[model samples]
Target: MNSSPPLSNLLRLAAAMIIITLSVYWMIFLRGLLVPILISVLLSILVSPITIQLEEKGLSKIASIILTIVLFLGLIAGIIYFATMQISDMLDVWPDLKRKGTLWFTQLQNWAYRLFGLRPQSQITKLQEMSMAFLSGGGSAALLKTTSTLADVILIPLYMFFMLYYRSFFCEFVYKVMAKSEKQRVNTVLFRICDVVHNYLSGLFIVMVIVGSLNTISLLILDINYAVFFGFFAALLLLIPYIGVLIGSLLPILMAFITKDSPMYGVGVAGAFLFIQFLEGNFITPYIVGSKISINPLVAIIGLLLGGVIWGIAGMMLSLPMIAILKVVFDHSESLKPFGYLIGEPVREESRRVVEEHTAENPELITDEVADSVKEAI
Candidate 1:
């Protein structure tokens, strides 16, 4: 006769939510040391197909793994060297940039004074005072923080090494611990997760290379200084999802503004970035990555914000992948499938019909579905 929800069910839901929130917080805060290693492992899993193919072609597993690691390291090293050289050149011209920036600000102030009859000089003085105050109060601590960040960056490669070495053993152990009935299900979910993450990363890598190369070439044609450095920075930003591209573009534009004393260079840079992003979003990504792990844009943005708040850069990087994994698990579980559907890309009814027809043609495929569905749903 009671119309209210069960107290036991409410308590269980509350407990689950609390646990999830705490786990996320812990991963964001305490797990900073392990983040790079985790990222390496995730990347290794995604690229394992290439390693396995090499092994199948007669190379030893260790040799294939070593080759993969070497290639990754070499690529990273090359980017760093190129970026450093270009940045050094850019820094050599900083005095000129500062002079140009001052001139630009002065012109802006003049324009504002002419149009609005306001004292632009007062605003400039206030800004200078605030900057000086900040430098005196917090700038030393900021320098130490920067140094600590550099130390973390140095540790990433070392973390990567151990993760790559033990990846296979870790995967095997995970599989071994599951009960017989749950083994297949767990394996299926894990494999799908790996596939989604791998495809996503690989597609992103290819896109970044294309985008970076094009940007570099465009800058060269435009006679922009530090073209290589800006190109590489743009490519790095592609790893950050939606906001990364904008941030990436700003750096080169700012550099152009400083070095050339011309707004046209900045305009050109922005235009090129827009074109590239359009191509990537519309054609490249969808075709290469497919709809296998389509996440809602809102969810992705929220995930990114929350990740940034919790784990900083690493959290931002892993946010979407973690969400994708959660979606996969929810899809496979009866009680959670509705939640999965909500997070997933729109499903085509025709595709669903096709899958249903295929399952009908092979009854064995439906055996686990009904049993698992009924048991879990109830």
Candidate 2:
């Protein structure tokens, strides 16, 4: 009988594993369809306040949503224009940059040969081969990829429009479908999800602007070419976790190495970016974004890896916010509250302070007599 119980448990575990595998496969298969929808939903939530404000100002619902979308598009266009101008300036100097880069590469190759006995000709040959391979294979693939992206870009605004238009219908549908007892809980969860998404998106944008400005000012001070481009490029890459800033910093460092007379300029560039990165991680993000999307590092990293596996870069960008929304839902659910806690930032200082202040007033509250109260406060 005991063996039967163990065997049954094993089967149940296997079943769960199978279901999870299938779910992952399904998501991968539907990625093209899903990415736009997910982006649209986030965009809708981000602009919900604008829509609401417009409605309050006596604009019709449809008109409000339309104006909000137009304003959003205009903002996106302005950013694109700014980036394009920066790119154009770089393109104008591309030939000179390439010549300098080639000269630097030749010098590095000679240095490598002297230090490590590596053949410089072999390095050049490999580089030529790789360039040839990319030229042969990348063109058609690039064109098709661009076409696919354009389709998604077109679909996203349409999705956002419908989603906004039917937002009320969806909320009503949820309430209508749920049991009366659960309606209150569902309503709370829906609001929490909206709030989390809105705050996270808005706060992230503000942080990006602040980080980008800092990056630009630092690079300009360093007299780096394409300072504005590199700065905001790095800021945009902040959407990716961990390595984004590193990639961002490397470009300017490479520029320093190519254009500047001294290697110390490269070192200076690296130092500047590292300092900005430190500020962004420690002071900037924490202060601006706050604890609204307070995902612990471990959980956030794991979610990011999983997201990358499922949907590449877009998935990675979406993962943290999605995890935050999930945590909110989990926190409100009796059965899943533990999982929410597991995902959350660990033992926040504010929570600790609350506990200490409460205990000072009533030390008995911390004792076994009221352990649940202590736990709740934490």
Candidate 3:
């Protein structure tokens, strides 16, 4: 006999869907307020190791946190200063670049006309019209957006300091909120989350540096202008994951096309970037970053899309870490374990067999402590 789902189950599913929808709406509504806080949380976790080490060396917690924050800010300021200098240099040569680009574009128009019977004047007119339309529509909006972004950036350090200072208080609050029986498991989960975030972030930064160096060397070999700037620019864009490198490649490609005599230089730039991307995905990332987050590709792509919709570029950059954190939380909850697994990498049969063997050897090992140990092994 065929059976329908229970009404209670159906009602529960409906409630979950409704709750998820409302939560997304709430997130979008509070995007500005939430983004900085979320960034602070991640940054705090990432640098907590430094704070801990400083505290171990006899500094007060507050002093350690402040020192860590200062070091972090100094690093960021250095990078920004260098990037700004690069941009200034590029601007200094902007007239030359523009003239060269115009000349190359004329050649492109001639080729287009010869191949497709298109008019160069019509093409130029259409481009001008589109450019004017875009600038006129977006200029004020872009200014406002930039101002808001600066505000958020200023708020991040303050938020991070408070978060790091009050870390114990938050842990205590979580312990107090959960049942005493669940305290040990909750603590384990918290530690796991922190460790995962720290490892993922630190490893990712290393991978970025390696990738950036490779990009710079390739550009230098090709004698590209501002090789360091463009190389690291593309590397920093790795924060946004899959599409970011492509976006970063655009400037270098355009520069090559405009500044070089032949369009083949642009093709060379494109091929170099694509090869770097391939190496990053297959070798560098796997070797350096590893599978600490363990998220499947499908979930990652979907999370990226959803994050972009909610908070634009920052959201996209934060999406994977946020999803990884959510998966950790879900893994610790019995009712939510399936959801965690849904977003995580597929388990192999060999891993499943190993787990089964462990359970068979020690039937009592089906506990939180044992489960986490097994999960770590996998």
Candidate 4:
């Protein structure tokens, strides 16, 4: 009793698929130039207020850009210096740590061997071999192999400087390209993009600073060695989302266990990081970086997977912001509204409808169909 999908519908679907594939291909291909530019644009947006302030105070555009870049580099250099100093101090005690680790690992291995009577080492060996193969390959070669994109991320500053310096020209060009009637829409889109990007990046950094300070103070109270190192590193890892949660918690817990005699210290370290993450996720993020990036989990996960395919880990890191940017673009454009809806988090009626339809049949079987229908409904 069902009719076949319309020929027009089929053609449109085919066309959309082709466009998406080609777009991804181009992204992967041109990533060398695009990646740096993208990073620079994000940086410029984050710091534009400062640049504008400087310009207002009588600094030339070039001078303002130079000063901003200099300040940025100085901040980076200071962090690198402190991190290196902490690492050196840690390395000074690495021998003792190594002994502790080796002894524990061997005991675990022996117990596992006796209990399981299976060769886990072969699998572990395979993993080691793969890791070594990846490491032994040069960084650039590895980058090219994995991402098919540029190896060097070092040029991001250069791109950022030029972008910031020429930002006005670019803005003018954008205005010139559009009809006067569309100017308001264009400006609205631009403002939304800038606000999302700036708020997202700036708020993320602020969260890192707050979380890192809280962690360091907690570790210091517990008298953990390398407290600053572990705390800051763990805090920074929150940038990676779910994977960040596991690794961030593990790093400090492992250090506490090794360096302190009490098992409670390990528990304390784990609890602190977990508690901080919970607070950040539930409380802090909402205030600072909330609805600006209200992407649904489904959309975000898909972006991460596709990003991994096209650009590997770097792509994964950038995926959320990119999706957020895309959502803004989609919202403003009439033709692309469906796409905006598709990629965005199901906020109201959308999520409710998906749930209702999903439960009517085998909920599990109908999930993807519900999602597709929702997208079509958009």
- Report the candidate with higher TM-score, 1 versus 2: 2
Rank list by TM-score: 3, 2, 1, 4
In candidate 4, which residue ranges exceed 4 Å CA deviation?
A: 118-154, 262-264, 348-378
Alpha-carbon shift of residue 226 in model 3 (angstroms): 0.3
* Candidate 2 vs. true structure, TM-score: 0.89
Cα lDDT tens digits, model 3, 80-151, are 999999999999999999999889988999999999998999988998999889988865488888898999
* lDDT by residue for model 1 (301-335), tens: 99999888877777788888888888888877879
Q: Give per-model TM-scores.
A: 0.83, 0.89, 0.92, 0.82
What is the lDDT of every predicted structure here? 0.76, 0.86, 0.89, 0.79
Question: What lDDT tens digits, residue by residue, belong to model 4 across residues 312-365?
Answer: 666777888889999889877888888887776666437645665666656566
What tens digits encode model 2's per-residue C-alpha lDDT throughout 97-133? 9999999888889999999888998888988999889
Clashes of each: 0, 0, 0, 1
Residue range with the least summed lDDT across 10 consecutive positions in model 2: 369-378
Q: How accurate is candidate 1 locally (lDDT)?
A: 0.76
Best by TM-score: 3
Clashing pairs in 2: none
